[model samples]
Target chain A: LKALNGDRRRWDIAKLIYMNNISPNDCIKRWKGEDVDEDHESEIEEEEEDFFQKRNGTASNEKDAHEGDLETFKPYFETLDRLMQKWKKTDLLKDRFIGKPAFSNEDDA
Target chain B: MAPLVFQGSENFRLRLILATLAGKPIRIENIRSNALDPGLKDYHVSFLRLLEAVTNGSKMEISYTGTTVIYTPGIIIGGSHSHKCPNSKPVGYFVEPLLYLAPFSKKKFSIVFKGITASHNDAGIEAIKWGMMPIMEKFGVRECALHTLKRGSPPNGGGEVHLIVDTLLAQPITIHELERPKIMAIKGVSYSTRVSPSMVNRTIDGARKVLRNIGCEVDITADVWRGENSGNSPGWGITLVSQGQRGWCTFSEVIGDAGEVPEEIGMKAAYSLLEEISNSAVLGRPQLPLAIVFMVIGKEDIGRLRISRAQIDERFIQLLRDIKTVFGIEAFLKDVDDPDSDDFIVTIKGVGFTNTSKKIA
Candidate 1:
C-alpha cells in the first residue's frame, strides 16, 4: 500500500485485534488504509490497556505471584500444539520490525 | 557497471557485502546526515577495514567529514587472518556477514575475531554456530566450524572466537520447505563466566520449569568458565535451540545484565523461544534474510519458501528492494490457500551467481 494520509494515520494494531470482531484480511486491509469504515473505528479504551499489557506481557508494574515469569497462556488449550494452532487461527501476530529507514536522509543528496 | 548509489547508514554491512560479491562499486551518501554526529559509526568503519583485509584490490574513500563512502569492489582472497573487533559490537556482528563471503573466497577461510562475545543486541556466537549452521549446511556448503576460545561480556570486553569455513559449493541447492515442522526436542547451554556457579543452575531451573509444561525432552548444560577463558568481564548467558524432525531450527538467547538475577534471563529466553514457535514462521526470523540472499544469487532455478505474513517486517521489505536494485530480480509472492496456514510462498529465480574469486583449476 502507498503512504497513507493524515486522517487514516497510525492505528494501534494490538488494540484493533483485541477490541473488534474483524476478519484478519480485512483488518490488514484497513491497517494499510484500503478500508476506511468509520462505524467500527472507535477510540481505544483506557481500561483495556491494562488487560492487553497482561496478555502480551508489556510493562506491567504488578505481576502475578506464580505466573509472573510466564507469558499469558490460553487456558482452553491442553497441548502446546493445540495452543499454537489456536494462535495461528486467531492470527493475532503483527509484523513487529521497524520499517522506517533507520537514520533518515531528509536533506538534499 | 554504474556505481549503486544509496542513502543512510542503515544496513551498512549487507550493502558492502553484496557490492563485494557482485563486484560492483557503491557510493553511499547522506549517512546519518542530519544527526548530531552526522557520520559513519566506528563499527561501520571497522567493518570496512575488515572487508579490505579479506579481499584484494578493494578501494575505499571517505569524504573528509566521513558522511559519504565510495567503495570499489574487489576479489575475495581468503586466508588465515585476525581482526580485533571493536567492543562496541559483538563478534556475532562480524561473524554473520562474514559467513556469506567465506565459501565464495579464493582459499579456505579462517579468521580470528576478538571482542565482546555475547550480547542482547545481535545473535550471539552460539546462535550462529548451533542454529544458523544447519541452515547453511542445507545449501550444501559444509566444513564450517566455530570454536569459542573466550567468553567476553560488554563494556570492558575481551573475548575471542575462531571461525573456519572450508568446503565450497558449486551452487547452493534449490530449497523448498512450506510446511511448518513440528518441534521434537529442546536443547540449550547456560554458561557463566567469572560468576558464581550456582547462578547457572538457577537459570536452568527457571527454564526447565517453563519447558516442563511443553511436553518435550529438554536437555540443558551448565558451563562455568574460570580464570583466563572467562575473559575480562563477569557475565552469564543462555542459548536455546529447538528443532523438529524436518531440520527446522529456532534459536533464543538472553544475556544477563550486570547484577541481574539469572532466573529472569532464563524466563526471558524461554518466553522468546515460545514466541518464535508461535509466530508461524517456517524459518526463524533471523535466518530468513540470510536464506533469501543466498537463494537470490544461487543456481539458475526457481527457489520457493513458505513463510508467515508476520515474518515480513520492514527490514525484510527493504532487503527485497536492495536485492532488486543490485541483482535486478524480484520475488514472486503468492498467498497460501491452505486452510491451516496463514503464510505466503515466496518464489524467486536465481541469478546463476558463481564465485569468481574461486576459479576452477
Candidate 2:
C-alpha cells in the first residue's frame, strides 16, 4: 500500500482499488487513523466477485479460451458480412449484363 | 484452266504480297548498286497501283526522281481473290511451298507469273497474277499483258525496266475463326461499395465470387494488405483478377497524421482510376473498363465541398474519351449528389477484353 501511494499513478491506482475491491479514499482515511466499518471491505469484495462472475460465467480455462476466439472472430465476420451486403445490390445489376461466367484457363503472362 | 493476265511487270508485286503476309511492309534494306534507275520507277508504279486497287482507298507517292509517280488506294478491310497476271513467260519464279488448298477445290487459288529476258523469246517482261481460277473462268478473262519497255539512251538510258502487276481474287474474309483469346479475352464485372483501400479488395472479392457462382474459373492471390496495420492504414493497394486481366484500384484515407483530404480529392482519385482503365486500352494493353464509385462520409464541412467539385471535373471528360477509344466503354457515376440512393453505383457497359495492340518482341 505504501509503495502504491508512492507510485501515485491513475491507472495503477484504479487497478489496485478495483482488483482488490477496496476504496482508495477509505484506505487512505484508515491509514490516517479514521474509523472505518470492517464490513465495507467485505461488501466491496462481494461486489467485485459478483461483477466478474456475471461478466464471464463459470467456464473452464479452455472453454474461456475458445469463447475468446469466438469473441475475436465475431468482429471480423461482421465486417465481412457488411462488405458482402454492400456489394449485393450492384452484383445483381452486374449479373443482368455480364451474364454467366465462362470457363477460362489459368495460363496468363 | 482459266488464263490469268498480269497488267505490269511481276517481280514488284510478288515482293508486296510477301511483305504483307509477313505482317509488315517490305523495307528497301539496300537497293543493288548496279540496279538500273528505269527498273525502280517500273517497280514503284506497279506496286502503288496494285495497292490502290486492293485497298480501294487511293494514295499518291512521288519518287525523288521526277521520272517516277506512284498511286495507291488505302488498305482493304477484307481479303480478296484477284489476279494480276495469268500466263506469260518464266523470267520470274512463283513458289508455293505449301498451298493448303487443293488445286481443284473451290478454295483453290492460282498464281501465274511471267519474267522478261531482254533477248530471250521464252522470257519477255515477266509478270504473274494470282487469282481464284474459277472466278476468272466465270468471266473468261484469263489472259494478261506483259509490257516490256525497250532500252533507251542516257538521260533515259542504262536502266533496265521492270514492271510488276499483281491481282488477287480473294473472297471477303469472314470472322470465321474464334477469336483465339488474343491479349486477355477474359471478362467479368466488379462491384465496389467504399472508397477505402480495403474495399478495393472487397470489391474484387465480390467480383470473383460473382464470377465463380456463374461458373467462371477464378484464381485469387492472398489478401494483399494483411496484419495489424491493415485497416485505416495509409497506402493500401491490391491486384485483383478473375483471370489474366489485372486491375489495380486503391484509395487511401489519410487520417490524423495527414488529416482528411477534402472529399473532392477522394473523388478525384476515384475518377482517375476510371480514366486510367479507359485510356489504358487505347495507349496499349487491353483493360477492362469499369464503373467505380467513391463513397465517403464527410468529416469536415470543407471535405464535402471539395468532393462536390471533383465529381464534375475535366478529368471525368478525359476519362470518357479513354473509354471510347477502347471497345466503346461508358461508365456511369453515382453518389450523394443524388440522394435516396442505397449505394453509389458506377455502371459499366461493354467492358471486356478489348485492347490496343502492337507487335511485341
Candidate 3:
C-alpha cells in the first residue's frame, strides 16, 4: 500500500481519523454503533482536545479552545474540511469541474 | 538505550553538521511524541526514508523525528540569522502545507537547525513565518530552498489558499463571506435580531469589556443601519457590531493595524486582538453598528447582507448629518446627499463641524 501511492501525497486515514474534529463523547452519542464517514471522523479528532479544555477551563491560546469556537470559527474549519473531501472525491469521479482551482469549488461537489 | 536526545543539543547538532559537511541532504519528518498507533508505524518510517534517499547524494540537512521533517538546501548552516536586512537579501526559506519543494536546478539546498517546536501542528509553518519575516530581514540574505518531509500540514491549517485569494482582491468582502457574522437584521424583519438597539448597547458593552481585557480604548461611535427603500431618509437602525457587511469595515481599520502593534512575546498584538474579537463574535453577537446614518433612520425590517467599503463610507456621511440635525450640533451637514463627501468630515477641520457628543452608553 505504501508503494502503491507515491510519497508525494500519502494520507494516513487513521491519523486523520484520530485527528478528527468531532468529539469522542459526541461520537459516542451520534456515531455510536454506526459507521462514521471521513468528515465526522475528522471532527472527532478535535473533540478530545475540546473535552480537556472544558475540564481544565483554561488553555494558553485560542487554538486550545478545543474545537474552533462553537459559533463562528468552527463552521469555517468544518466547511474547509468538507470542501477538501469533496474535492478529493470529485477528483476521483469521472467528470471534473472545470475553470476552478483544484482545491476550491464547494458547490454541488 | 539511545542517548537522551535533547533536540538541537550538541549530539544532534554534530550529526547535522557532519552530514551537511559530508554533502548529505537533510530531512526532518513528522515530529510527534504522543503514543502512536501500530497502524501508522510503517508509513511514518517510509516517509522519512524517502527523504533520506532523495538527498543522499547532496549536501543538505535533514531533521527527522517520527512524522516531521525539515529539509534545507545546502550545508546545515547555523550561527547566522536567516533574516534579510535593508541592504541584503534573505538566506533562509520556509513554506507551508509541508509541500515537497522540487528544485529546477542542481543547487544543493542548505539546512539550519532551528530546534523543532511542534512545527507539525496545523498553521505552524505559516505562523512561524510571521515571526521569521522580521528576523529574516535582519540577516541580509535572500532566497533559500525549503522542502517538507511530511505530507500535509499548512501554516494556517490550510488557510493559505484563502489568504492568497484575499490578497489579489483589491477590497475585502462583507463579513458574511470573510468571517460569517451572525445575521442580526433579517431582510424584512423590522429589527435585526443579531444586533438591535437593545442588543447593540449590550454587545458594544461586551466588546468594550473584551477590549478592556486586552487593553485598548473602546472609543469611536459604531453607527449601524439599513439603507432607505427609496429617497434619502434617516436610517437609524441597529446592527450586530460584528455581523453583516458593515461590521468588517468598522473593524478593518483596527484589523489592518494589527501588524503595527507589538507585544512582549508571541505574534503581533494586532493579530491576537483581531483573533479575540473574531472569536468572541463567534460565541455570540455582541457589537452593534449605530443607526441614524443611512437615511433609513426611521425605517424598519431591513435585510442583513454584505456591504462594500464604498457603501459604508456613503452611509457614514448620512449618519453624521442625522447626528448633527437630531442633536443640533455645530457641524453643517455637508450635503447629506453629497455624492462626493459622505461622512462629511469638513475637509478643513477634519471634524464634524457640528460635533455634538452624546452619552449613548
Candidate 4:
C-alpha cells in the first residue's frame, strides 16, 4: 500500500492510522522484554559509553552508535505492528450518517 | 547521507532551525504549491538569506518554480551582521529564529535588524524583550539581550533593533517540576510612534480600567517616540506581560489597525493578557517552541512541562515529528487526570547532544 498519495502531499489512510496508534510506554515496555545475556549486556554498556563519548569528540567508532539507535527504535516498530492489527478490526472509514438529516422537516418547510 | 524530508511550508522556520542545530540536511517540497502565487514569497527568501548570513559555506537549492527547497547547513559562525527584513512580516519573525541559534554560535553574536517591529499577526518587540528574554535566562543563556533602537510599524517599515548574545554553549538545565507561582505584578508597555502622544495616555488609561478590575497590581508605562526615533509608519500598540515568581511569564499584545481606537486596542490587549493569566498552565503559547528546543538539546533526562490544551495543535504535532526526525527524540504527551484541569504534561528524554563544534579555549 502507498504510504503517501501520488501528489505526495497527503498521507494515506494506513499511514495516518500507523501514526495515531503509537504509544511510547508500550514501546519502552517492549524494549525491556528483550532477552539480555552477558555478551549483549557488555555490548550495551559499550554503546552507552560511546554515545556520550562521541558527543565529546573522543569516540572514533560510528558503527556501534548506529546500532544503538536502531536498537532503541526497535520497540516503536513493534508498537506500530500492534496498532495496525487493532486498527484493522475497527472500521474507522465507515460513514456513520448514511441517510438524510434528522431535521429534514424544517428544511422542507 | 540521506537527507530528512518534509512536506508543505507550514512551520518552515522551526524545521530550518532544527536542521541547523542538528547538523542535518533537509528537503522541503510543495512549498505553497497550491496557492495562487505558487512559490516561495519574499519573506521566505529573506529568511533563507538571513540563515545564509549567519552560517559559513551553507548550500541551498531551489527548484525552477521555487516549489521545492534543499538546505545543507554549515557550522554556525555568529558575528555582527545586518539584514533588511522583508517589510511584509514583523521583525519578530526573524528574531524568533535567531533566539534558537544564537547561543550555540562559534562567536559572540550581534546583529542590527531593520524592519517592522510590531504587527497584529506576530508578537510585539516588547513582548520578546520582557517575556522571552527572562525565559531564555532560565535555560542558562547568560548574556542575551534585545534592544529596540527605534519603533516601526508595518507596510513601510524602517525600524531598527540590536540583538546581542554571548558566545557560549547552553548548559542543560532541568525545568521538570513547575509550580504555579504567585503573580508578582502585571506589567505592560503602551507605545505609540508617529502619532499623538495623547494616544499613549489613552491606551494606558483604557488598559488600566480592565486590569484594575482583575485586582492585580498593574504598572503600565507609556512610551511616546518622536522625531527620528519614530519609523516611516504611524502606529500605536500595547503589550501586557504577567511575571511570575517561578520564572514563568505570559504575554499578550494588540497592534492598532486602521480606524481602530486606541482605547479599544488597549482593552483588547488587556483582556487577552487576563485570559492568558487565568489559565492554569505554567507556560504560554509563545514559549512552547523555546521549550521544545530546550527539551531536544538538554541533558539526557526526561524533561517535563505542563502546557494548556490550546497549545496542542497541528503545529505542535509537526514539532514532535520534527524532533523525532532531527534529534532521534520521542516526545510523549499525556493528559492530566484531574477532571477540571485543561492541561497536559509533555515529556521527552533528550538525545544528550553537546555542542562539539565550539572551539576549545
Candidate 3 lDDT over B1-361, as tens digits, reads 1111122211122223222322333443333434453122442333233334323333233334434334342421122122111111011112221111211112223332121211211122222232222112222112332322211111111111111100111111111122333322111111111123443343334334322322212342433333221112221111112222322222211110112211111111122223323333212111111111211111222212222222222112322332332323222212223332222111111112110111121
Candidate 4 wrongly placed segments (more than 4 Å): A1-109, B337-340
Docking class of 3: incorrect
Poorest lDDT segment (10 consecutive residues) of candidate 4 chain B? B309-318
Alpha-carbon deviation at B170 in model 4, angstroms: 4.3
Error of 4 at B342 (Å): 3.6
The clash number for model 4 is: 0
| Local distance difference test values of all predictions, in order | 0.73, 0.26, 0.24, 0.70
Candidate 3 backbone clash number: 79
Clashes per prediction? 0, 42, 79, 0
Off by over 4 Å in 2: A1-109, B1-12, B29-33, B36-44, B58-62, B66-74, B77-361
Model 1 stretches astray by more than 4 angstroms: A1-109
Predicted structure 1: clash tally: 0
> How do these models rank on TM-score, best leading?
1, 4, 3, 2
Q: Tell me the DockQ of each model, to 2 decimals.
A: 0.03, 0.02, 0.01, 0.01
Question: TM-score (0 to 1) for chain A, all models?
Answer: 0.26, 0.18, 0.19, 0.17
Tens-place lDDT per residue, model 4, B239-267, is 88887766778788778876878887777
Between the candidate structures 2 and 3, which one is better when assessed by TM-score?
3
lDDT accuracy of residue A30 in candidate 1 = 51
User: lDDT: which candidate is best?
Assistant: 1
Please give the distance, in angstroms, between residue B211's alpha carbon in candidate 4 and its true position after superposition: 0.9
Model 2 CAPRI rating? incorrect
Tell me the lDDT of candidate 3.
0.24
Best by DockQ: 1
